[model samples]
Target chain A: MESVGLVPVLCVSVVLFVTGVAGVLTRKNALIVFMSVELMLNAVNLSFVAFARQNGEADGMIYAVFVMAVAAAEAAVGLAMVILLFRNRVTVKLDDLDIMKG
Target chain B: MPTFNDLWLASPALLLFFGAMAIMLGEAIVRPASKTGFWALALGTLAGSAALTVVIFLGPSADAFGGMLRVDQFGLFAQLVCTLAALLTVLFSDDYLRALNLRVGEYYSLVLFGVCGMGLMCLANDLMMVFVALEVMSISMYVLCALKRGDPRSVEAGFKYFILGAFSSGLMLYGISFLYGATGTTSLPGIGGFFMGQHQGTQATLVAIGGALLIVGFGFKVASVPFHMWAPDVYQGAPISVTSLMSAGVKAASFAAFARFVYGVIGTHSAGFVGVLWWMAAATMVVGNLGALAQRDLKRMLAYSSIAHAGYLLMALVAASTGNASNNPALASLLFYLLAYTFMNAGAFIVLAAFTRDGQDYTDIDSLAGLGKRHPWLAAGLSLCLLSMAGIPPTMGFVGKFYLFSAAIQSGQVPLAMIGALSAAAGVYYYLRPMVWMYMKEGHTEARVAPVAFTALAICGFALLAFGLVPGPMLGLAQTSLQSLIPYTIPTH
Candidate 1:
C-alpha cells in the first residue's frame, strides 16, 4: 500500500464510493440513505484532497472547501426535509412516497 | 492590482448582488404587502442588472477571477433573458400569491436571489463556480416551489424536487471530478487545453468519458428523456408561478450555460456530439409528447410539453455541433424558440393561475370547459397561447419552429427536422384540446379578479403575433446574440 501512489488512492476512493452507493441503494430507511449520501460525499472529499496534493494545485483544496460548505447545507436541508417527511407519512419509509404514481 | 478590467468583469454580478440587498432593504422599509414598492424595486433591480449586462456586452469579452468566470455576449444574452423573466414573474406574482395566501416577503427576495444565481451561472466559465451558482439557484427554487406550504401538492413538489435536485447536483459534481482527473483543472479553458494539447489516444478517451458524465449531469437538470421522470410530477405539484419560472427561466439559463460548456470546451468531433445528443433529443421529443397525450391534468400536460421543448432545444444543440449551426442557422432557431416558449408556456400558466380561485388549482382539462363562455378574455388569451404552443401559423411558436426546421434541413439533418415537425403536429392535438374544452364543453369558470392583469396578458398575446408576423428584427437580434458568442476561443494552457 505504501508503494501505491495517488492512482491507488483514487481507486480506494472509488471503492468507498461504490460502498456508499450500495448503502443508499440497498437501504430502505431514510436515515441510512442520508448516511450513505454523506459517505459518498466524504469519499469525494478524500479523493479531492488527494488530487489536490498530487496535482500540486490549490483548486482541488478550494473545491474541497466548496464540498464541505455544500455538504453542510445539504445536511441541514436534508434533515429538515426528513423530519417533515416523517411528520407527513408517520413512517420513515422511502417506499411510502406513492402519491405521484401514474 | 485589481484592474478596471476585473471591475468591469464583475459588474453584472455586482449589479445583481447589490440589487438583492436593495430589495431586502426596500422590503424592510415598506413592510409587508406593499405590492407597489416591492414590484417597483424588483423591476428596478432586475432592469438595472440587465442594463449592466448590456453595458458589459458592449465591451470586449474576457475571463476574470483567475479564469473562473467569463463575461461575454453569451453570458449577457442569458442574463438578460433570466432577469427579464424574473421581472415579469414579479409583475404578476403579487396578485397571484395574494390570491393564494402565500405572498410572503421572502418570495420576492428568493426570486431575486434565484435570478442572481442564474445570472452568475450563465457567466460561470469554471466547473466549481457552476456548482456553487447552481446550488444557490436550486436551493432558492426548492424553497419557492414549496412556498405554498398549505397545499399538500406544493410540499410534495418541493420535497421531491429537493431530493432529486440534490442527487443530480452530486452526480454533476462527481462528473466534474472525473473531468478534473482528466484535465488537472476545473476551468473550461483549462479543460480545452488538456484536450488540445493531448495527442494521446487514452487522454482523449478519458475526456470523452468525462464529457459523457457531464452530459448525464446536464441531462438531469434540463429534464431530457430518461432524465425527465421528475418533471411532470414536480411541475404539476409546484405553484403555478414556480412552474412558469422553471419551464422558461431555469430552462433558458441552464441551456445557455450547458451550451457554453459543451461548445466552448470539450472540443469533440462534431459528429460524436451530434450523435449522442441526436439520440437524446429524439428520445425526449418522442417520450415527452407521448407522455403528454395520456395526461388529463393541465399542469401535467404542460410539464410533459416542457420536456418536449427541452428536446427541441437539445436538437438545436446538436445542430450547433453539426454543420447546421453555420449553414442552417441553429443558434438563431434555438434562441427564437426559447423566447417564443417563454411567452406561450408562461401565458398558459397565467391562465391556469386565473382559474385557481376556489381553494384548489384547476388542474384537470375538464376544469377549463366552457371557459370561453365563462371568462371570454381569459379563454381567448389561453387559446392564443395554446395555438402558439402548437406551432400554428401567425403565432410565435410557428415562426420558431420554422427557424428550427429550416436550420435542421440546412444542416443535412433532414430526419431530425422531419421528426420535429411531425411531433409538433401531434402537439397540435394536446394544445388545441383545452381550447375545444373551453369553447365546446359547458361549465362555469370565473376568474376571481375581473381585471386580472389583462395588460400583461395582452402584452403576451400581442408579442406572439407581432414576433410571429414580423420575426425579422427578433431574428436579427437572435443572430447578433449568437454572433457575439461565436468568437469564443478556448484558451490553451
Candidate 2:
C-alpha cells in the first residue's frame, strides 16, 4: 500500500478511462456502452481520491462521493432509456437505433 | 451550516424544486382530468422563479451556502432567461401534447425540474455543483425527449443523447479531478487565484489538458461542430416543445457556466486557448450554416441554425479572453444574444408546434406553403422570428450579431469576425427559403393556432422587435450584469 503513489494511481485511472472510452466507441451493444460509461466515471472517482490524498484535502474525496451518487442516478435513468428502446424496437444495438437521420 | 439568508438567496431554485415535487405528487394522487392544472402550476412556478431572479438581479451581488452558489446579476440574468424559456415552453406544451397523444402530468414536472437544474447551473460557483446541476438538467431532458415512448424515433433520440451526454460528463469529471490535483480546490475563484499566482511544472500541463477537456464537455452540450452529430437527430426526433426548451434553455445555461469557467480559471491566461476557440468558431459557423442550406425539414434546419448561433456566442468568449475585463463587451454581448435567441428560437418552435394536423407534425418546408394567405397573422409572426434569426435590421438578432462581431474586431480578431459575418450571410438564404414557401408558393392548409401558443409567439415576436428597435435598456442591463464576474477574474498583470 505504501508503494502506491498518486502518479501510479493516476496511470491506472487513465488506463481504465481509455478502456472505457474504447468500449463506448467500438461496442454496438447499448448495455455494454452504458457499463463503459460507468467505468469511466469510476475511473474519475479513483483519480479524485488519489488527488485528494496528494493534496491533503478532503474536497476531492467528497467530490468523488458526489460523483458516485450522480452516477447512480444516471445509471437508473440510462437503464430505463435502454429498456424503453428495447421495448420500442426490440433491440438495443446502436446501429439498429437509427430511425432518425439526415 | 446554512442560514436563512442562504435559503432566501437560493429561493428561485428551491421554488422550482418544490413546485416540481408538488406536481409529481399531484400527478400520482389526483391524476387530473385535464393537464391545465399542472400547466398552470408549472407556469406559476416559473413566473415566481423569474420574479425572484429579477429581484436578486436588482439587489446587491451575494453568495450562498458558503459560496457554492453565487447570486449575482450575471447568474440572475441567466436564470431569468432559463425560467422564461421554460415558461414559454409550458405555455405552448399543453395543446401540442394533446395533439400528439402525449397527455401526461410528468411533462410539466420534468420541465420544472429541468429548469430548476438550469437555474442551479447558472448560479453554481463550485465544480461539484456544476456537475450535479448539469446531470439534473440533462437527465430530465433525456426523459423528456423520450416522453413519446411509443415513437421509436423519440426513444432512440433519448438513448443517443444519454450516451453522448454521459460520455461528456465523464470526461468533464476526469478533467475536474486533474484540475483538483493541480490546484487543490474545485472553486472557480480558487482555481483562478492558483493560475494567476506564479505556477510551474506539471501543474501547467494538467491545467492545459483539463481546460481542453472542459471545453469538449461544454462544446458537446452547446452542439458545436465536430461534436454536434446528435443535435439534429435529437431535435428532429423529440417533441417540438422539448426541442425548443432544449435549444434555448439548455444553451443559455451551458454558456452561462462556460463563461464563468473560462473567465474564472483562464481569464487573461488564454493565449493558447484563443487560437483553439478561433478555429472552432470559424468551423462551427461555416458547418452549421452550410448544413442548414441542405436540410428540407424545418426542424432540422432550425437545429442547424441553433448550432450556428452557438458558434457566434463562442466568438464572444474568445473576444472576452483576448481583452481585459473592464474594457471587453464580449460577455455582455453573449448574454444579450442568448436572451435574443431564447425569444426567437422558442417562437419559431412554437410556430412549428402550431402546425400539427391529424396527429402528425408538418415539419416539411413545403407544408408552410401558402400560409401567408390562409393564416396571415401566424405567417407574419413566424416571419418576424425567422427574420430575427437571419440577423436582419430592426430585429434583436441583428443587434446581437453586431455587438458580438464588433467585440471580436475590438479584440483584434478580424478574420474570425469576417468568417462569422460571411456564414451569417449564407444563413440568410435558408432563413428566407421558408418565407418564399410561405408567401410566394401556392398550396392549401389550415394550421391549428392554439390561443395560448399564439399569445406566447406574439410575446416573443413583440419582444424581438421592441427590443431590437430600442436595445439601449436591455443592452445596458446585459453590460451591468457582467460586472459581478469581474471579481472572480483576477488580473494576470
Candidate 3:
C-alpha cells in the first residue's frame, strides 16, 4: 500500500480542481470555460476513484461512473447551446453574450 | 433482489419518467395539430403522480432500491409539491407558449422529465443518487430555458445556467469524494452511523470541509447570496412559465434533499458549519432584498425576491439544526413555506405571462400601470400574489414567515430571525410597488390576459388567502411528514 499514498493522490486532485476553477474564472471563451468545467468534473472523478481504492469499496467507484455519465450528458447539452448561441449572435465569447442587464 | 414492492415504492417518479417518454413518442408519431393534447397529457401525468405519492404516503415508509431511495412521508410531501408546481406550469404554459409562437412538443416532455428528476431527488438516500437526480433536473431545465431559440436572452440564460450548474456539480462531487474518504460510505444512514460512533477524530476536518462544500453546491441551486449572480439574469431571460418551475419546483426539491442531508447525516457534527449557514442566511436576506429594490423588470424583482425567500428557508434549517429531537418545528416550517411559495410565486408569474402578446414579455413595472382600471381581475390577482410575497397578513406567505421566524426564535436564533425580519420589511417595499403601479398610476392599457393564466392566478390567490386564514391543516400535514425523518437523525454516541 506504500507504493503511492492517498495523500499524494488527494493533493493531485486538489491541484487539478484548482486549475480547472481558475480556468473557468479567467477564460473568456465559452468553449474553454465549458472544457474547464469538464476538467473539474474529471478531477472529482479521480478523487472518488482514489478514495474508493483506499477504502476497498465499490461505492465511490460507482459514484465516479455516475458522475462521468452526467458530465457527458451535460457536455452534449452545453455544446448544443453554445452552437445555438453562435448561430444567433455570431460569437462564443462570454462577455459578448450579455443582452440582458440591470 | 429488487421486487415489485420497490417499483411500487418508486411509482411517483417512475410514472413521471414513463409519462415523459410517452409524450416524446406521442409527439413524434401523432404530431398533434394543437398543443392542447400535449398539455392535457402532461397535466394528467403530474396529477397521477401526485395521487400516487399520496397513496405511498398513506401506506407505509420504506427504503427501496438497495437503500438508494427512501419512500417516506417527507419525501412524498416534497414530491407532491413538485408535481403540483409542474402541473401549474403546464396549465399556464399553454397560452403563454401560443402567444410567444414557441409552441413545441418538446416543452411538455422536458417539464415532465424535470419533474421526474425532482421526484427522484425527494427520495434520494444516497449521495450518488442525489447527484444523478440533480443533473437530470438541471439538464432538462437548461434546454427548457433555451426552447425559445430565436430569443437571444433565452439562449444566454440557458448558457449561463449550464456553465454555473456544471461547475457547482463538480464542486459537489469533490465534496462527496472527501466525504466518502472520511466515512468510507456514500449512504446517508451509513455516514450518520459513522459520525455517531466517532467524535473529534482525524477525519473530522475532512468531513466538515465536505459538508461545507455540499452547502455551497446547494446554495448555488437555491440561489443563495454569493452564488446568486446568475439568478436575476436567467430569471429575466427565461420564459415566464419556465421561471415559475425553477422558482417553485427546483427550489423545493433542492431544499428537501439539503434538509435531509443536514439533519439526518451531519446532525450535531455541523456545529462549526452552522456558523457558516448563519452568516449565509443573513447575507442572503440582505443581498437579495437590496438587489430587488433596484430592479425595474418585474421578473428580475421576483428573482431577487426568490433569493430572499431562500434566505428565510435557510434560517429554518439553522433553527432545525439547533432544535431538540422531540419536535422539529423548523422542518415543518420549511416544508410549509415551500408549499406557500409554490402557489404564490407561480401565480405571480402566470399574471406576468398573461401580459405577453406576440412572443415578447411586457414585464416592466411601467407596463403594469393602470392595469387595475383596465383589467380588474388581472390586477387584483397580481396584487394578492404580490401581497402574499410581501408577507402581508391574510396570506399564506404571512403564515409561512411567522412560522419560520418563530421557529428561529424558539431555537434561540433571535439575531438571525431579526435579520430575516428586517430584510423582509425592506422586501415589502418592492412587492408593493407593483400594486401601486397597478392601482394608483395611469398609463397605457395594452396588456392582454389569457383565460387559463387568469384562472391560475385566481387559484393561487385563493390558496394564499385560504391557507393564510387557517394554516392549521397544512401545518399539521407538514408536522406529520417530518415524523419519518426522526429515526434518521444521528445521535452522538
The most accurate candidate by TM-score is 2
* Location of the lowest summed lDDT over 10 successive residues in candidate 3 chain B: B484-493
Off by over 4 Å in 1: A1-4, A22-26, B1-9, B22-37, B197-202, B267-273, B324-328, B449-452, B487-491
Tens digit per residue, CA lDDT, model 2, B193-252 = 777777678998888888788888888999987889999999988899999999999999
Full ranking by TM-score:
2, 3, 1
- For each candidate, the alpha-carbon lDDT, in order, equals 0.78, 0.90, 0.89
Model 3 residue runs over 4 Å out of place are A1-3, B199-202, B487-493
User: What does the i-RMS of model 2 come to?
Assistant: 0.7
User: Which prediction has the highest DockQ against the true structure?
Assistant: 2
Model 1 C-alpha lDDT per residue in residues B314-379, reported as the tens digit of each score: 888777767533333787788788888888877787788887764567778988988888788889
DockQ each candidate and list the results: 0.47, 0.92, 0.88
Tens digits of per-residue lDDT for model 3, B267-345: 5555777788888899999999999999999999999999999999999988888878569699999999999999998
Reference-based TM-score of each model: 0.93, 0.98, 0.97
Pairs in steric clash, model 1: none
Screening candidate 3 with a backbone cut-off below 3 angstroms (N, C-alpha, C), the clashing residue pairs are: none
Q: Which DockQ-derived CAPRI band holds candidate 1?
A: acceptable
After aligning candidate 3 to the native by TM-score, how far in Å is the CA of B293 from where it should be?
A: 0.6
